[model samples]
Target: MTTTGAVLRIQLLGPVRAWRDGAETALGPPKQRAVLSLLASRPGDVMGVENIVDAVWGSDVPRTAVNGVHTYVAGLRRALEPGRAGRSSGAVLTSESGGYCLRVDPADVDVTLFHRALHAARRSRGQGEAGAALRLYGQALSYWRGEALSAVPGPFATMERDRLRDLRLTVVEEWAADMLAAGHHAELVTELPAAVSEEPLREKLRWLLILALYRSGRRAHALWLYEETRDLLARELGIEPGADLRTLHEHILTGHPELLAPGAGSPLPVYPGGLPPGTPGPVRLPPVGRDFVGRTEELARLEEVMRGESARGGPTTPVVVVGGTAGVGKTALVLQLAHRLVDRFPDGQLYADLRGADPERGPASAAHALEQLLGGLGVDGARVPADSAARTALYRSLLRGRRVLVVLDDAHSAEQVRPLIPRGPSGVLATSRRYLGELAARDGARLETVGPLTAREGTRLLAMLSGRRLDERGPAAERLVALCGGLPLPLRVVAQWLAANPGAPLGALLEQHPALRTRFGPAEAADGVPTGQFHVIETS
Candidate 1:
């Protein structure tokens, strides 16, 4: 576990050591190590300098303790990064307004990963994927070698250790539940009683042991185990078993078939029609219309707006709005651009589907979108305001001074996006079917209009989608491109149809769907204007 680029490997069950690269790095007396450990435990959160000083020196800190804290952070960074040549951008420790944050990747920390995996397992169980839930729960439990933060000696260390121990016990209960769901009652008979012994106060664990015993045909032992646990709880804690546990005991006594139902013996609590509890990745969008083809130049231009030289000249709060007709690839271009520039905003990248201008639903309220964005940024539910104006104000306030990238996809108009625009030195990219002229004039946002793909680009796009050499197919590819009207969405749809229907001929496809020709428009340009028509292909 490294904190702020410093390689720190701690074995609470054994020795604790800090290293820089391959060499041992001393943690400047012992007080400094305690301060570093506390900060590392909560990554990405700003810890005030004064609070850190007080933590390390307690009431005995000198008048210059604040300066000492700075020196300690600087030393820790140097130790973590060695000569500093390999220091990552933002490093492990970063300075914010009135404090500093440890920016360690959560995956690199064992405790963090353990908690995350445990949460994932519980969620999987809720989703009715018992096999996946069991695997995840087992993997989470495997991370525990011994007591957490064991080698570290301090009040904070003791508190953290106890917290982790409790969390581990909760995970153990989840594990037993997953095992029972997987129909391993006989195997759990031996395992669950030992777990109950380790965590005697937890009624849930005791309940699981009784259920496992009853299912394994040890009825007398199961009842005896329940009595023993109830007596211990009453004597030690002056409390009765929880309602769930008592209910399970009574069901076992009555020979209820529920006790024999698959997964009934598990102690996993059920959520009340809520989303599964776990760390979920971003939602993936399904493939929209495949008629989309070509537009290489437009794609490149949008890329330039995001990462090219043109993007730098915009206002401090740069805005790039892509507009086009329905099915014109505005959202596609914006999505592609955002994916490419994800690394640019190390702070974070945010995306929202405003669903504005959609055929089914009217435009989403600015206040609603603001609420979603605020929630995504870790704002507590109670802290979010109810009013639109207040929400917008709070959203902008939160965004101020942060270098984040915001993508509002499928917006209705500039009016819908204006209030949603965050202030400060951030970048805002929006997509709309309508040309937002006022946004360009007032907000100095650049507008990029996506047009139909060129003939060659359209052919290439079809070739890419079909996974075949279009040149080998000759006039058929050209005819198909022209038939699709050089529209990417249509071309993709036709290509998918062709790919799926492998035995069909391109000529037959064109002959049966002559309407495609009219959809592509005329071949020749009228006057000096280019023909908007391209060759058409049957999609529906």
Candidate 2:
């Protein structure tokens, strides 16, 4: 006989809910909730009748409590297995050994999924793939909608709640590390302060904020972060910063090169070839540009920086900065570089859009980026600090010695990218529309400017994208290149339009679509290319 796929799920940690399939089952009485909570905690593990009685009644057990417990268990079994309530399928709650056990898969329990994600994220870190590891951790922590067992009552719920809370702190530490790896230092400045306030005992988080402050060029603020964290740790935990944190503070105070070093941080965890436990399914990247072309010189420069060795020796990685005008292929070049360097940074590569120059809202704060990065690192929500300084310090500490590639895409300026710089010997690549002159002068950074592709390059790119032999198309291909302004972005956009409208003739497309003319405006327009298409083409 085929077994029913039905399983009981209790969520007391957040809002309380119990269900089998789409049907709701009433968990009768206070004791019934308690019984369910107990079984849920140790699903598949048999609990003796006496242990269940004590867990429910504690020291206030009554003479007839045994009979009441049995009645409650029987009712729960019926409610859980409504279809097999009276059948001999022996499913739902099963009789085992001396007592009974809830025979349910660990994934059926929310707590189990949460723990599995956390563990898997940790394992990813162990494998030196910090970027993938952080994402897994964040996915796992997101499963929690609210407090653990929020609807459940009794001692069992209370105990499990505390345990999950403790696990949250470890998650926070991992998250801080990931943010630092991802180059979100400026954003962390705002968040670390709040994190420290919320988690006063976590000295590691305070150190993270300090590092963020220092790297963001707020030397005083960075120092202040250390002082505040030190004070809080002393008053609350009656302890001092851990060895790693203390060392980081000294490095900051003495102006250690490692503090200013590119990608100087711990290696984040890596994904181990499967969806983290409890995830609905595999996480997939969204569809981005496919007809990407040109920017070869820019890509080569980024590749050199990513592969360059640290001058200070001891496995130091180089830092490369790419700056240019809007629509100049900065993002494209960096992304391409990241893909190429994937094998080198086996720990995994991380990318974040800093939005430094956004006209509307200010650039994303370092703290916010840190929070997201930390979440990716498997740091639990409850454990993440409310203070920015703590978060940065924790971030730096985590990166003390790991090889990972971090790409900070669309940065506004050097300050925005500073604190987010990792410390160890890993690689860091940043792209921005504005020139970060000071960063190059002060930090020994290599700046590469990306402009329009060469004519030959543009024609080659068009031919490759069109999937037709350029030699065969000859003049037609040249006309198409002339129509694109030699700008990769526009070329790719036009190429995609062509690929999608395969049946349409090129001459007809050029005649009907005003964008084709506008894209190659007067500045770069060839003698015969139209300008109206440039105006018509929407480049969002």
**Candidate No. with top TM-score:** 2
TM-score of each: 0.42, 0.45
The alpha-carbon deviation from the true structure for residue 189 of candidate 2, after best TM-score superposition, in angstroms, is 25
What is each predicted model's overall lDDT from 0 to 1? 0.66, 0.65
lDDT (tens digit, per residue) of candidate 2 on 323-437: 6555446677777777777666654455667887666677888777766555544445565567886666655544445456677777777776766676666667888766777
Score candidate 1 by lDDT. Answer: 0.66
The count of residue-pair clashes in candidate 2 stands at 74
Error of 2 at 97 (Å): 83
